[model samples]
Target: MSDLYLSMGRKEGAAGSLYWAIQFTNTATTACALRGYPGVSALDTSHHQIGPAATHSGSSYGTVTLAPAHSASAIARTTNGPVGGPCLRTGSYLRIYPPGSRSAALVPAPWKTCSGIFQVGPVNVDGTF
Candidate 1:
């Protein structure tokens, strides 16, 4: 995990769905590989989980090999619930666990979500859905 850097990248919205690019950069001297969906969940200001963790989406699970300074990305999608609904809440951050790793990295991203139930896709080198 120390050899990787995690950050939120581009974002787009359509209708009631919000999508963000979760970027993973190889910061070490050699190459690394990432596979499958990363674990994602929303967090409050106190670093506590705000709601349920993100669910896995899509089926293109393939290994992405990253050279030093290279990057791979996954798409995270969340839908908005009705206003004043119990599932609607604002989160201050996103906790991301790289695939097959126990360590996590938090990225500051304040946004409204439906019970923090994000749908995350597999890591890809193209950084698109």
Candidate 2:
């Protein structure tokens, strides 16, 4: 995990749901493989988790082998709560645990979610999703 760089790609939305591409780039000299869904959660200003961790979505858990400088990505989806609603909260950042890794990476993601119920897809080769 130390050899991987994590970042957000772009914001996408449909209906009332929000999506973000969680990008993982191989920064090592050799290749690495990432499979399954990454662990994701929203964090507040104090770095405390807002709610339960993201649930896994989809079954496309194929191994994504990334060579140096290559990238893989996972899609995270969540729904925003009504303004001033009881379930609404603004997350200042996100805590991401790469597949098969115990270490976590943090990325800035100021977004709102209803109870932090995020759905994340498995990692796939770049441009495949």
Candidate 3:
């Protein structure tokens, strides 16, 4: 398997929800293929998993071929809430596992949720900027 690097993208606020792009870059010299939804979870500063695991939103899944230095991305959406809410859970990092891969990469992402649920979209072949 090719080595890939995961990075957190900018957060975009829309309506009463928030969306963030998750970038995946091919760091290895060879190409790699990625498909479906990635496994994502919030992690505390201590590296412990927090809240419920993220869920995939879209039904259709497709494979993306990643060439060296090329990238693919996914979007994660969560409900926006006040500073203090009944569903609040804070995490400083995100553990990401690419589709069908066992290894995980840690990406820095400061997150607060009113609901423990996170809906992740599918990976785009073009990366959709």
Better of 2 and 3 by lDDT: 2
Candidate 2: 10-residue stretch with minimal lDDT: 79-88
TM-score, predicted candidate 3 vs. hidden true structure: 0.88
Model 2 Cα shift for residue 31 (angstroms)? 0.8
Worst 10 residues of 1 by lDDT: 80-89
Model 1 per-residue lDDT tens digits across residues 13-45: 877778899999999999999989899888889
Which stretches of model 2 miss by more than 4 angstroms? 80-86, 126-129
TM-score of 1: 0.89
Candidate 3 or 1, higher lDDT: 1
Per-model lDDT: 0.84, 0.83, 0.80
Model 3 score (lDDT):
0.80
Global CA lDDT computed for model 1: 0.84
The TM-score of candidate 2 is 0.88
Segments in model 3 whose C-alpha atoms lie over 4 Å from true places:
82-85, 126-129
TM-score of each: 0.89, 0.88, 0.88
Better candidate number, 1 or 3, judged by TM-score: 1
